[model samples]
Every structure is written in structure tokens, then in C-alpha cells.
Target: MERQRMSTSEELMHLPWWMVLLEGIAALIIGVLLLTSPGMTTLVLTQVLGFYWLIVGVLALVNLFVDHSLWGWKLCSGILGILAGLVIIRHPLWSTLFIPALVVLVLAVQSLIQGGIKIFEAFRGGGFGAVILGILNILLGVVLLSAPLMAAFVLPLVVGIFALIGGVAAIFGAFRLHNSALRASIQQTPT
Candidate 1:
């Protein structure tokens, strides 16, 4: 007999339900922390980022010895990463302000790019919805770019709100997955 192939979602749903439940719980806790103590929590996470960048930078430079194909790019990235890591680590308070603002700027740039793509698609016959979306994206991008530092201050609260919603949804999805699996198992079992 040929084995049946599972759909992507079916395969994903087969993940142990307990794992999803645990993830939900963790996300919920993080959301609460972020909302309650946005500054402290963000600071702690930024510290972790500092450590990660430092390690990755060191590794990149060391990797140069093993692979010399892109020496220039690797060297440049390694040095930049190292400097960024060191600066962030040395000045925690500054990093908390600078990092978020930098990220907002990047997001603004991304929004602009995406908006341009949407408009291009609209011209190629994607309809008015795409054009409207494109316009909104451009507007938002401009707004963000105009006040990245101000947006940075609100970033944590926004993230916290998203986390809380995601956590709650994940918790519900986990239970649904568990029930679905239980029903599937029951159907498969021989009497």
C-alpha cells in the first residue's frame, strides 16, 4: 500500500501539543513583562543581543581562516559587528534608545520598498486595492521616517500588545490541536 502524504498544515499540526502549550505560556509571560516593565525588559534583551553579536562577530572573523572566498565582505562585516556589539555593551542606556530608533528607520525603509512594489503590481493589473495599500504603506513609511526616535519609544508597547494577543491565540490553538489529535488517534485505534 502506498503511504498517504500529509499536507503542510497537517504535518505542522502533528507537532506535540504540549510544546505549543508551553510556547503560549512563555509568550504570555513575556508579554506581561514587556507591558509592565518595558524599559527593564528591553534593556535585558538588548544585553543579550550585545553578547550574541560579539560572539557572532568573533566567529565571522575566525571563519575567514577556513574560507577565503569573501574575505573583504567577511572582514568588513566582522569588524562592524564587533564595534556595534562593543558599543552597545559599553553603553546600555544609549543602546536602548539607539537600537530601537535604528530598527524603526530600517522598518521605514522596508515599508517604502514594499509600497513601491505594491504600486508596481497595481500598474501590472493588481487592481485598486493594491494601489490603496501601496499608498498607505508609503504614508506610514514617511511618517515613521520623519519621527523614528519618537516611534522607537512606542515600539515596546506595540510589541507587548502583539505578544499578549499572540500568546492568548497560541494557547487556544494548542488546545484545539490537542483535541484534534486525540480525535484522530481515537479514529485510528483498532477496537
Candidate 2:
């Protein structure tokens, strides 16, 4: 049987709007909790990350059979993620020491790369805001790299703010999906 590929928007349209709304609400709640209790949030976040990675790994592995293209890289990535997640979940105490270090290092590298891209975009006629954001990203990357341990402590606060923004975006997305579905249904109804 041939597999039918759906466009991103079409796939999204098929999704139940209530599911999106629930996801947004859940993110909002988690964001609020993280912001309110940073210390506890870090541990919780670590555990959640582990579970996320594990689930993603499993999904990716499954997808390897579904989509054979780039299967090698997908398999490797899935296995690595699964192993890392399992190790972290099985040994929370040991994970606490190394996970934070790893997280900060990854964040530092991502910030640096993003900063560079933004700076380049700014030079290519992007707004002043881009330049400012680029500078801030570079500065943050440097600071995080300098004291990664400290950066780990601050990670929860930053993550909370980002999560809040994401939650808001998801809520808006859910409404948009709902409206589109309503319109589609109305159009399909007999006059």
C-alpha cells in the first residue's frame, strides 16, 4: 500500500482542536509552576526531559521503518537519545550532576549559533531589534559558557518564560484551528 503524504496544514487541520487547547493549557500550567518554584522545577524538568527524549527516541525508531530515507542517521540518533534518556531516568542522582552540565553546554552552543545567524541577518538589512537580540544572545552564550554550573541554576527561570510564550502561541494556534474547522464545516453543509 502506498502511503499518502499530507501537507503540514492539512495534517494540522485534521487534528482535534481540543487536543491543541489542552496542550496549551498544560504548558501554561507547567510554565507557571516552573516560574513559581525554580529549584523544584529543575529536577522536574530534568525528569520530564528524560521522558521526552525517551518517547522521541521511540517515535524516531518507529519512523525509521515507516520512512527508510535517512534511516541510518535516524537510527543512530534514536539509539543515542534512548540510551541517554534511560541512563538519566535510571540514575537520577548521577544524572543531576552531568545533565545540568550537558544542558548548559548545549544551550551555549545553540545561543552562539543563533546569535551569529541573527547578526548576519541584521547586517543584511534586518531590524535593530535583530542586532540587539543577536548581541544579547552572544553575551548570554559567553556568560553560560564561562560558568555553566551557574547557568544551570538560571535555566529554569529562562525555560519558564519561554514556556509561557509557547503556551500562549499554542492557545492562539488552537483558536485558529478551531475557527478554520468551523468554517470548513459550515461550507460543507447543504444550503
Clash tally, candidates in order: 0, 0
lDDT of 1 at 61: 98
Alpha-carbon shift of residue 166 in model 2 (angstroms): 1.8
Clashing pairs in 2: none
The positional error of residue 116 in candidate 2, measured at the CA in angstroms, is 5.0
Q: Using TM-score, give the best candidate's number.
A: 1
Q: What are the models' TM-scores?
A: 0.83, 0.68
Q: For candidate 1, report its TM-score.
A: 0.83
Model 2, span 114-147: residue lDDT tens = 9998999999999899999999999989998999
Q: What is the C-alpha RMSD of each candidate to the true structure, in Å?
A: 3.7, 5.7
Error of 2 at 127 (Å): 10
Candidate 1: segments with Cα more than 4 A from true spot: 1-6, 58-82
